[model samples]
Target: TLFVPEGIDDPEIEPGYVERAFATASRMTPFWTEKSRQAHDIQVRSGTFAVTMDGAPIFGPLPGVPGLFVNIGYDGHGVMCSIEGARRLADLMAGDAEHDPKDPFAAERFLDGSNPIPEPMTIHQVQ
Candidate 1:
């Protein structure tokens, strides 16, 4: 996966960029040979999205709103984490489990004087 920097204009599904990435990737590992890269069919898709102020997800109720809850900001790993996130958010909303307002993943973290220092965006820091 390419870590396109934040301010650059969006290429918006540029095939040349994808091909170049595959070419570079092929050179990095024996498993991704030139022929293998060429043979693999590639499909491209695109979207606009937002990441959170801090990298971690925001889960649980919206502050001061009794019936609303939010479970967002998974960065790019929403598919991997959404099941547990939804379960935990449901537990909070259903009152089936104790809900901690100060829980690390809680939305209140941004407002309750508990916001953590934002981490640098790096490949090693992902997840």
Candidate 2:
């Protein structure tokens, strides 16, 4: 659930990123005390910080690639919106629903000019 905003091109995690994560955790939580500075059973995940021009996630079939669907472009809200996108994508793939350009999160919105300008992002940070 760590949602760091920085981007990296390669899979190699920078040592400083870990350092900064520890620093942030220690600052933001009482549980991350000096006694528990070390972490065990770490898991790694890597993915592109994909963003669309309209600042919304895409969930549906690929425009031309048959038998392929995409659930992407969460921008920075993947932590919050991923589950909803998965549900919608499943419905679309199963023929339970159709792509609706009217929905801002729809993948077809880009093709139909329904979503052109980016939506304003609501980013908040703890001091």
TM-score of every model? Answer: 0.69, 0.55
Clashes of 2: 0
- For candidate 1, give the lDDT: 0.73
Q: Report lDDT per candidate.
A: 0.73, 0.73
Clashing pairs in 1: none
Best by TM-score: 1
Model 2 clash pairs are: none
Residues 10-105, candidate 1, lDDT per residue (tens digit)? 446765867676678787976767565466566665664445667778888888988888988887778888889999988887889877877888
- For residues 1-127, what per-residue lDDT tens digits would candidate 2 score against the true structure? 5566644443666556655777788888867767346676666555557888877788787777788888898888899999988988999889999877567675667776553776666432335
